[model samples]
Target: MRAADPALDSLQGLALGDAFGDRWFSVPIDELSDALAVRTLRPAPWPWTDDTAMALVLVRHLITWGEVRQDALAGDFAAEYGREYHRDYGPAMHRVLRGIGSGGDWRAITSSQFEGHGSYGNGAAMRVAPLGAWFADDLDETVRQAELQALTTHFHPEAVAGAVAVALAAALAVRTRGRRAPGRAELLTEIAGRLPDSEVRSGLRIAARMPDRTSVRHAAAVLGSGLLISAPDTVPFALWSAAGHLDSLPEAIWHTVAGGGDTDTTCAIAAGVVAARTGLADVPPAWLAAREELPDWVAEVSTSS
Candidate 1:
C-alpha cells in the first residue's frame, strides 16, 4: 500500500534502491566483474554507493530548508563523499569531491574534471526523488528545483536531463499515491512531454514502447544497464524497469539488478519510480534492516523540518 505521506515513500524508495545497487561492490572483484557481464545480482545487505549518500544530502537540504541551496548542497555532498570515499563513486567525481573537501573551488574542480568534459554521469538522477515527491503538486516546481540540485555537480545537458527525468517520474508517481499507476504509455508520455527532447528523453520514449516485452538482457542491450555510466545509457533501462513494474517496487528493483551494468544505480532509479506509486511497502523488511545505517546527518536531514 502506498503511503499517504509522499515524502517518506520517496525517501524509503530512494534509500532502499540505493542500498540494493551498492551490494555489487561487496562481491569479489572477479565475481562482480563477471556478474556485470551475465546480468546477475549477489543479493542483499547491499551497502549503498554514492547514489544514496548524495541523495541523503539532498533530502537533508530539502527537509531542513524546503528548497535547494546549491552551495550548501554541494558542500554537503563533497563532505559526505570524502568521509565515505570507498563508495562506488566515479573517478572524476572522486577527484572533484576530494578537491572540494580540500577547500578548492568547487566550480573549478568539477569543471576541470574528465579533461574538462565535466560529468555526464547519472549521479544527478540517482538522488533527485525527494525534490520531485515534495513538489508533486507542481511539475514546474519539481523541474526547477531539480535543476538547482543538479547544477551543484552535474552541468551537462544530458546530466541535467537525467535529473529532470527522475524528478518528473517521481512527481508523476507521487500523484498515483491513492490510485492505480498510470499505464506504461501514459507514464512514459507524461515524463517525456514534461522533459525537453534529449538523449535521455529519446531513450525514455523507446522505453515507453517496451512494456515488459523485452527480456532484461535485451533491454540492457537496447537501453543500456548503466555500464556506459552516462545518462543516455543508464536512464532508459532504469525507466523501463520502473514502467514495466510500476506497481511492484521489489519487482522493479529485481529487474534492475537482473539487467546488470550499473546495478546499483539502475536499482535506485527503479526504486524511486516504483516507490512513488507503491510507497515503502515495496521495500523488503530484511533488505531495509540489512542496509547500513545512514549517518546521523543523513537521517537528520530526511527528518528535519
Candidate 2:
C-alpha cells in the first residue's frame, strides 16, 4: 500500500481504454468508419475484455506481494481465468490457464504453447503498466518484476521484451508525472535502449524515428497495430501514442483506437502507460461514465496495505 494512487490511476485508465476500444468491435464497418471520422461517442456501459480482466489480476498481485512471485501470480491468474473464461482470451491463453488451473506447473504449461516456441502474445504487454508504476523508483527492479510476471504465461523473448518495454514506459511515466516528459524521440530512444534485441526493440527504434505529425493509419501500418495479437505488432505503436499524449489519457486512447487493430489491447497498453503519468486528470467525464466499473476487489485491495 505504498502510493497506490498512481497505480490505481493506471488501472482505471487501462480498464476504461479496454472497454472503450472493445466497444468499437460491435459496430458496423460503415458506421465505425463514420464514427471514427467524427470521433463519435459510444453508448454507456462499455464492457471490458480479457485485457482489463488480466490487468486487474496483475494489479491485485502487485497489491498483495508488492513484487512478482511467479508461482503465486500464476495461481491467481488461473483462478481468475477459471472463474471467467469468456473475456475474449486467445486460444493459447485458454490452454495455458486451463492447464495451470489443473495443477500443472506454470513453466510446463507456458512452455507448451506454440509447440514449445512459447507465446509472443501482447497479453503480457497489455497488462503491465501498473507494475511499472508500482516500481517506478527502481527501473531495473521494474524490468525484473515485469519479466517474471510475463514468463508465467507469455514465455517468448519477444513477449518478455514487450512487457519490459511497456513496464519501463509506465515507470518513466511515473517518474515524469505532472511534468513535461522527454520529447518523442528521446522518450522512445530511452525505452528502446532498455530492451533486449528483439522485434519489440526494433519497432521502438522505428517509432523513435517516425515524425509526430504522421497520421494514425500511416503510423499503425508502419509500426503495426496488434494485427497478429503479438507483442511486436502492438507495443511500439501503443508506446508511440503514449509518448505523444502523455498529458491526456483519453487522447492517447483515441489515437490508439484510430489505428483499428486489436484496439482493446492497444488502447489498454497506451492508456495504462499514459495514465501512469497523467493519471485521470485529463479523462473526460463522458469517457469515464461509459466505461464499466472495476471489480470491487480492486477497490478493496487499493484501500488495503
Candidate RMSDs in order: 3.8, 1.5
lDDT (Cα, tens digit) per residue for candidate 1, span 184-219: 778887788888879999998888887556788788
TM-score of 2: 0.96
Q: How many clashes does the backbone of model 2 have?
A: 0
What lDDT does candidate 2 reach at residue 186? 89
Residue pairs in collision within model 2: none
- lDDT per residue (tens digit) for residues 1-305 in model 2: 65677788788888988999998764554676688889887778888999888888988888777789999999999999998899999999999999999999999888878888899999999999988998999989999999999999998999999999999999999999757777888889999999999999999999999986898888889999888899999999999988988888878888888888888899999999988888787688878777888888777766773
TM-score of each: 0.88, 0.96
**Lowest-sum lDDT 10-residue window in model 1:** 1-10
Best by TM-score: 2
